[model samples]
Target chain A: GAGVSQSPSNKVTEKGKDVELRCDPISGHTALYWYRQSLGQGLEFLIYFQGNSAPDKSGLPSDRFSAERTGGSVSTLTIQRTQQEDSAVYLCASSLAQLAGGNEQYFGPGTRLTVT
Target chain B: AQSVTQLDSQVPVFEEAPVELRCNYSSSVSVYLFWYVQYPNQGLQLLLKYLSGSTLVESINGFEAEFNKSQTSFHLRKPSVHISDTAEYFCAVTRNAGGTSYGKLTFGQGTILTVHP
Candidate 1:
């Protein structure tokens, strides 16, 4: 693909319902990341996937938040029993490879999740 | 863990004026620095980064940032501001350690730049 792409650009869900956000990283990119941008806050790292496996899930806020990547391509972020505080912009990014320190990540057009 | 700090939350300036957004980082080990910009209702775009080399880095859009290792700062600056420059700017850092790495980035609370005409 041209760049990282995310599905459901905008999603409004009621409290207590579950929601899923998806991301398709750039082709052949080996590293993928998830972040949450709350109103008036910085980008909060959620999880990082190295191909089909996730090695750094340290940033996941809680047990309700979980993510998985399949076939080293698409990723899904699931929020069980969504809460009002979950309203934020969900962002996805991918990098070519982690070497010699770091690689610049290309970002997706983020999904704006609104829980009421 | 590494952390970034953006001093000001919001900065309002008149068009054609110079601007500087301050950022500081903390890390126990060597790390790469970066500045990202987010436009209205858009995803963040990498403006510039300081992986290694000269302390100075630039963007095509006339914005520049300097990585000061001694001070642990990577401040973004521009000589002149335009209305189109209004956006949210973020400073980020990632570890340069050796290990099974996924390149997780730690970001600062963004600074919102408002350019007045």
Candidate 2:
């Protein structure tokens, strides 16, 4: 793909339900990241995937949040028992390299998740 | 761990006026700095970055940022602003320590720039 892409641009879910956000990174990009942005708040790191594995899952707020990548390509962020506080924009980013240093991330359009 | 601080939450200015958005960071080790801009209903785009070399870095959109190591700041500046410049700006940092860590950026609360006609 020319740029990172995300699906279901907008999603409205009820509290206690589950929601899944998806991201398709740039073709051949090796690194992928997920972030949550609340109203009037900064981007909060959630999880990151390198290839088909995730080495950095420390940012996930709780066990209700989980993510996985397959074939080192697309990724899905699943929030189980979604809470009202989970209403935020879910963003996905990709980078050419997997190293922590000396890399620039390309971001996707982001999925706006609204929990009612 | 690293953190980013964007002092201002919003900055309003007239078109053709100069603008500056301040950003600061705290980290024990060396880090890479970056600035990104997000237009309305869009994803963030890289504005500029300070990876190495001269402390000052520039973007083609007439925006520049200076990486001040001593102050741990990477303030973005534009000599003149335009209506098109109205957007949200974010500052981010990632530790430079070599390891399995992929660049997980720690971002600041964005500053929304509103340019008046």
Candidate 3:
């Protein structure tokens, strides 16, 4: 089975420009998450989507960051008016389901965004 | 809020030597623990997890972690390591929340393990 996949492995854009990163979760995965990894921040959760319920945007650092999951499969994370501080590796993960204890998350290669 | 702390930032060991990476977490409620490994230029992979039942969990690749509730720790250990074991290890935690969980993981500052031949 194919693991989670992300498009545009690398993206470089101007500081004020907007960028969208895409993610394709594994088949049958009902939960998807987005995280950011940077040299200073380590790894930080950005957002999560489960089934059709409203997405968990609690982890979004600021209002400029947003994400949407269409048809419960593919997810897109959009950053508006990106800043140099937003330059980081964006990783996508998916799990079979969100259980009480925990569910293993499969990760993608990640899209490295560089805000110039 | 939950937070994870990995004591060591880097561990350099000779091949075939025992290794231990310490991890401690702080949370007001029960949580699930996990160890993730990332080889250079690759995505993170699940190494092992401690959800429930046994306090000790083992991975297929000779790695094991023991969940210590009292100590609030889940440290990874291996009797012997190989050169291929060199990678960055991250310890993460998510709240149990009793029922259907939608919590995000709180990851530690990764520990880089460099196995020397």
Candidate 4:
């Protein structure tokens, strides 16, 4: 892909329902990241995946928020028992390399999830 | 702990007027600084970055920012604003903590730039 791509550009669900967001990063990129943006707020770091090493899940807000990246290409973010507070835009980004000094992440369109 | 702050949540300027969006970070370690812009309903796009070079960096679209180490600030500035530039701007930082920090980046609260005609 020329740039990162996300699925279900917008998702509206009931309070107790579960919602899944997907991200397809640029091919051959070695690093993937997940972030959430509340309405009129800044980007909140969620998780990060680099190659096949252990993912950094320190940013997951709660136990209900979880994500996984498969084969180091595609990633999914799942929210179990979504709450009204979960309504926000979920973004995914990937970088060509994992090094901190030379990595500029490319972001996807983002999935706007609204829990009614 | 590293945190970035955009002091002004919203900035409004007339088209062709000068504008500046302030960003400051608190960190005990050296970090990389970045600026990203987001149009309405669009994803964030990188504007420019400060890794290692001259204290000032310029973007292709007439936007520039200067990295101030002592003040811990990376403020973005534009001499002339365009209506098309009305969007949200974010400041981010990436710290190099060796093994613990690989590709993770922290961002500020973002400033909404509204360029009125």
**Top lDDT model:** 3
Top-down DockQ ranking: 2, 3, 1, 4
TM-score of model 3 (first chain only): 0.96
Second chain TM-score for model 2: 0.98
Taking all chains together, each candidate's TM-score versus the true structure is 0.96, 0.97, 0.97, 0.95
Runs off by more than 4 Å, candidate 2: none
What RMSD does each model have against the real structure?
1.3, 1.1, 1.0, 1.4
Q: Which stretches of candidate 4 lie over 4 Å from their true place?
A: none
lDDT tens readout by residue for model 4, A1-116? 38999999999999999899999999999888989999665688898888654468888989999888888788889999999988999999998776554488999999999999
TM-score of 1: 0.96
Best by the TM-score measure: 3
Q: Which of the predicted structures, 1 or 3, would earn the higher TM-score when compared with the native? A: 3
How do the residues B22-65 of candidate 4 rate in per-residue lDDT, one tens digit apiece?
Answer: 99999888888999999998899999999898999999999999
Candidate 2 lDDT over A1-116, as tens digits, reads 38999999999999999988999999989889999888866698998888989988998989999999999999999999999888889999999875556688999999999989
Q: What is the lDDT of residue B15 in candidate 2?
A: 96
What clash pairs does model 4 have? none
Runs off by more than 4 Å, candidate 3: none
TM-score of chain B of each: 0.97, 0.98, 0.97, 0.96
For residues B1-117, what per-residue lDDT tens digits would candidate 3 score against the true structure?
899999999999999999999999999999999999999999999999998999999999999999999999999999999999999999999989955467578899999999999
Q: Give me the runs in candidate 1 sitting further than 4 Å from their true place.
A: none
